[model samples]
Target: MARKTFNAQAHSLCLLVLVIVDAAAARGDVVSANASGEAMAQREFDYFALALQWPGSYCQRTRHCCSSSACCQSNPLAEFTIHGLWPDYNDGHYPSCCRDSDFSIKKISSLMPELQKHWPSLSCGSPSLCHGGKGIRQIFLYLNRNLLRSQFPDEKKHGTCSYPVILDEYSYFSVALDLYFKYNITKILSNEGILASNAETYSVEDIISAIKKAVGALPLLECRRGNGLNGDASSAISWLIVNEPFAPFNVL
Candidate 1:
């Protein structure tokens, strides 16, 4: 899955969060058809902020070679694809936007099966057309959440400096491993709803709503608990991260 960035041509906020910032200006690249148009959505900003802060571990930060040795360089698609698969993987590294670090794998792992159960085809569709490939759901969720937000900021207002919670707590490796295994768990738990050998049954909105509901149900202690069966709050963060993990473009 290719991590998506905000397209100022199509959206409002100019920030590009989680995915690689380098791709924001690159041309001739094959982005999702909906990406350009959707990049302007409202959720883009939230997703973008979270995504931009991803630690070097999952983002392959060292790979980014820039003319100036200032900011970390990266590929949006690579980052998005990798992060979207599992959102709760926070490693104690303050993503650039903020200065903090902590890896919370157990917190993120608990939500994987529910995600898979809700949207089976999430990472299984065509990479270009929003189909399979492992990280597609992660990328798409980020894009979907922020795309519309970016385009219509006036319509839907989100706080500019909302503190990033989940990514700040887990590790990518732990999260991914959980997702891989939990997918099977979802099938076992929601067997009637989940047909064998079929893709996830829920729509993107359904998955998103479930995530929100799950997170809203968490108590302060529960939220802090994080990792390993932490329940809805963990799941909510996972869902948000999966949908929008990139920051708004920071170009002129």
Candidate 2:
């Protein structure tokens, strides 16, 4: 397959990567065959696309800022956050809203802290109501309620399609969290002296090489034109196809 490359224009930063995983292996089950000797393991999707987003770039492009939004918080995030985990096909097509599963905050209560820190919602909510002078307890309640509502769409859309491999909403989110931490892109870039800066500019090859060295694969870069403070740009690593030995698919 021909690998795709996105040129880093004005101010590009690595946003996300679509990592591929074997469905059967992910479920920890051996493939079965029917009476006619046909493989019974029919995969609903080809791979998982783990999309991440840079808070700086997202906030910059967002014109309306709400107090409840992560970008408008007292201490805005300085790191990339989880955007979504989508089930995609190799042919550039995908499925959504596969099943009717209601998202529950209580199921992932333990992960709230990490989710809030790493997967916060960028979209605006009822700022006045979210930040209303209601007591600390009331504010917490409101935020939790909002979180459930915000996360439901994703669970219903993408998470549901993940099916047997991911199981439920908790698993869907937890798996993404695990992958995000396992491949710490920010740390990887910093190690190569590719720190986010307004005055400094980096070569696209250097950025790709740095990530390839760290992750054992080439990453796709994407740049956007916006009213960024210093021509801030973003890059996205297309797809990482994973097999038994966990080798990265050659994108060259």
Candidate 3:
């Protein structure tokens, strides 16, 4: 009878020990998950920088415009296109390719029409039937495939890392387009009599002033050596950087 009693107590103790271990393991998993969440939260960028690219300057500087880009004679666009909205550290260094997210056409479906008009792909497989040219499924599929190469990195690297930043993927791209509409540098320069022309070179300081006066804030101006015939002629193209990540972007 004593032996049987001891056996029962041992079986009960074993079951109790198993239950305690399971509870400890569950708590450990929760702790690990919380730590991971905190780490990803810390990965949020310090600031956001919107980089605008001018096709005229790009074609001039490169000396070779892609047949599909805005610089194409068949479809010249005076307005600047979005180069990227980068996540930057205050000191100027930026982070990129931080995470991976599948490129979903549905995510950008609504923006496709506008993107074709404004952010047309620079390089393409079928240049003759570029998205703006043929307007068919072939071109559509091509953009979906090539966006991963040409322009989808923003979502992967910066956008995904931007936790608690904004609404979602749609919001991210839309906000950028909204900012583009608000700051039309071409219009600002024209008002200041600093028009874009290969014939006459405009001073960089004047260009910066034109933008600042319009926006009521300072900007970061970047220049590139033109590959155009007037490469030496003050016809260099300039890029502007406007990202204040710590603060919310008030697109007005």
Candidate 4:
């Protein structure tokens, strides 16, 4: 099979946390196949890819953004937030919606405050759009209600595949939040003088080198042309490979 690759055109800074599978396993030497030649199940994965997005860049590109959106609020986010923590193979093919688990808001209720601050939904549109006289409090209530109804799409898609290791929804989100806080990409860049700016310009090499120096690993850099913006937006993705007999979470 042809190996797949990551090909996302991010508008703002993004981060990908890749957990590489063992060389022997990734090479498919130990993988088992059914008698008909099809792979038994799609649960197996080579690694986990945690994606982080910058609200400033995302909100800037969104045309119909409104106050309902977290980034569009009066106090906007000036930092990188969690996009997703996906389980992916070395070939780039990832397992998603592996099981019939539904995303439940109550499952991770304890983590609501942190999730709201770190992994907020950037999607826009609210009752205020259609109905007038709705205050911010009402709009927030409407949004929260919507969140309860829709649940988290990422949980049903990527989080489900993180079974046995991740265990449950709380664990899955907790792990991601922990990793995001630990890495602190926003602080890392700021420490290297790579602050978000409209007038300043930075070379791609400098950005990558700074992250690599801080994290002690080379990262994949992705950039996109901003709409009527001064410079291109860049995303830095980093990964760590883990072999068998070792827990993937411990490596980070």
Best by TM-score: 2
Q: Provide backbone clash counts, one per model.
A: 69, 7, 4, 0
Q: For each candidate, what is the lDDT?
A: 0.23, 0.56, 0.44, 0.54
Deviating ranges (above 4 Å) for candidate 3: 1-42, 60-73, 124-149, 229-252
Q: Give candidate 4's error at residue 192 in angstroms.
A: 0.8
- Cα lDDT tens digits for candidate 3, 1-252: 211111111001110000000111111111101212222213334555566655555444334544444444574556666666655554545444333233455776788667666555544333221112221223234454533224443334444433335445666677667766666655776788865454555555565566667865544544434443233222222233333432223222
RMSD of each: 20.3, 9.2, 24.2, 9.9
Each model's TM-score, in the order given? 0.18, 0.72, 0.61, 0.69
lDDT value for candidate 4?
A: 0.54
Residue-level lDDT of model 1, residues 96-187, one tens digit each, is 11111232334535544543222222121122322221222343333223221121111011111122322222233233334334322223
What TM-score does model 2 achieve against the real structure?
A: 0.72
Model 1 RMSD in angstroms:
20.3
**Model 2: runs farther than 4 Å from truth?**
1-14, 23-43, 102-104, 125-152, 229-241, 245-252
For candidate 1, what is the total of clashing residue pairs? 69
Per-residue lDDT tens digits of candidate 2, residues 5-83?
3332223334666464643634422232333434344346766767676667666655786544676677756676777
Query: Which stretches in model 1 have alpha-carbon errors above 4 Å?
Result: 1-83, 86-170, 183-186, 196-252
TM-score-better candidate, 1 vs 3: 3
TM-score of 1: 0.18
